[model samples]
Every structure is written in C-alpha cells, then in structure tokens.
Target: MKLYVLSAGAGLLVGIIYSLLNVRSPAPPLVALIGLLGILIGEQVIPVGKQWLSGTAFSTACAKAQAVNHVCGQLPGRQQAGQQAQSAEEKQS
Candidate 1:
C-alpha cells in the first residue's frame, strides 16, 4: 500500500514536470515502455538495499525482494501453487 502511494506520488511529480515543460501526457510507446520498465526495476531498489544493509547474502536479498514477481507480476495459478507449497512446508514442519 505504501509502495502504491509512493508510486502515485512519483507519477504525479512527473506529470507536473511534463505539464510545466509542455510535454505530452502520454509519451511515445517506446519511451513509455522504457519508463515502465525503469519503474519496475526501481521498485526493487529499496527492498534490495535494505537487505544489503543488513548484511544478507546478495542472492538471498534478491529472493526476498521477489524482483521477478514484482516486475512481471503473478502468472496464472501462481497463487494456488504458492499456497500448496506453503501447505506442504507446514506439513513437513
């Protein structure tokens, strides 16, 4: 939720900058795609940074950040698969 709010705020700032510069609201498709990609990667920075600061292994930090999931989003049936995995783990425990 906080991440969403921050994302909206960043977008609002960019929109204001664009308006002041007389740039169009929606940039060209290539430019927009690049920007969206940057946003996706940027969102992982803080989580990774925090883990790094705490001395976690780089691979572990990346796993905790779930960067791929954040960028590509959940696939079809991913939630159910994850739940089943969790249940299996609990059964083992």
Candidate 2:
C-alpha cells in the first residue's frame, strides 16, 4: 500500500540521515517500539473505561469489545472486514 511505502521511505531517509551524522537513534529500537505500544494502549483506556461505566451487562461487554475493535481498527495495515462477516452471521441466526 501507499501508506506502507511512504512510511518505509521515511524511515529509510531518517536512517540515512542519522548514519551521515554519526548519531544514534534517540532510544534503542525495542524501547522505542514499547513506548509506541504504550501510547496506543493508553489512548484506548479512557474510551473503554467510559463505555464500561455507562452500560449494563451484555451491552457493556459488547460495547467494550467494540471499543477495543475500534482502537485496533486504526492501526496501520490491519483490516476489519471480518467484523462485517461476523455481523452477517449474527443476523442470519
């Protein structure tokens, strides 16, 4: 996809620049990756917490699951087409 290509290009450019400057990345690759993951999880907590506090049983659980799905739906390169398939199956029964 174009988005992936663009991101890869940007990362490659940064690596080249850093190499030319003889400077290390701001953090170790693993540490930086973990920090990014933390940021993503933190973004979903508030919305999911609000859903939990406002709803009753069954709906609350469904809402919480949906909230998580929505959060994950935003991640790059992930597809949510299967969610439609699940909805279709639910409707048939």
Candidate 3:
C-alpha cells in the first residue's frame, strides 16, 4: 500500500513538472500503462521459458521465476504466507 502510494505520488510529481514545462507525455496515458504492463510481463518471459525448456511444469516454472508475484505485485495471500514463514522461523530460533 505504501509502495503504491509512493509510486502514485512520484508519477504525480513528474506530471506536474511536465505540465509546468508545457511538455507532452511521451505516450497517451492508457497506452503508456499498457506498454508498462507489457514490459513487466516480458521481463519474466526468459526466466520462465528457460525453466520450461528444462522440463519443468508451467506452474512450477512460474513459481520458481516468481513471475506471477512480480507481475501482479505481492498479493494478500502471499503476504500472509510470508508472515507465517517468518513466525515459523522465529519459533525455530
């Protein structure tokens, strides 16, 4: 949540600066967003592809590459899982 807020704030700041300079954005907002989405998904392709080529299952390849988490952001269930893991580690300590 904080990261999202910070990202929005940073974008807002840059928009303001561009507005003050009378500069148009490089791309339309919707197009830029879609392009960014593509870039994020594209980044995971190679790692996932390599794992798959090595005979790993699709789901396991994605998990090993953390492609879903990277593209979708850390989900609620993932956060809970991470917290649980931390608790278990602390218990063992």
Best model number under TM-score: 1
**Candidate models: Cα lDDT each:** 0.83, 0.66, 0.86
TM-score per candidate, in order?
A: 0.61, 0.39, 0.53
Q: Which of 1 and 2 is the better model by TM-score?
A: 1
**Backbone N/Cα/C clashes per model:** 0, 0, 0
Cα displacement (angstroms), candidate 1, residue 8, comes to 5.2
Lowest-sum lDDT 10-residue window in model 2: 71-80
lDDT by residue (28-72, candidate 2, tens digit) is 888667756765676666766676677646457546556555545
Instruction: Give a tens-digit lDDT track for model 3, residues 1-93.
Output: 999998899779867866887767896788668757976898899999999999999999999988999898984377889999999999999
Decreasing lDDT order of the candidates: 3, 1, 2
User: Per-residue lDDT for 87 in model 2?
Assistant: 85
Best by lDDT: 3
- lDDT of prediction 3: 0.86
lDDT for position 13 in model 2: 81
Evaluated at residue 22, the lDDT of candidate 3 is 74
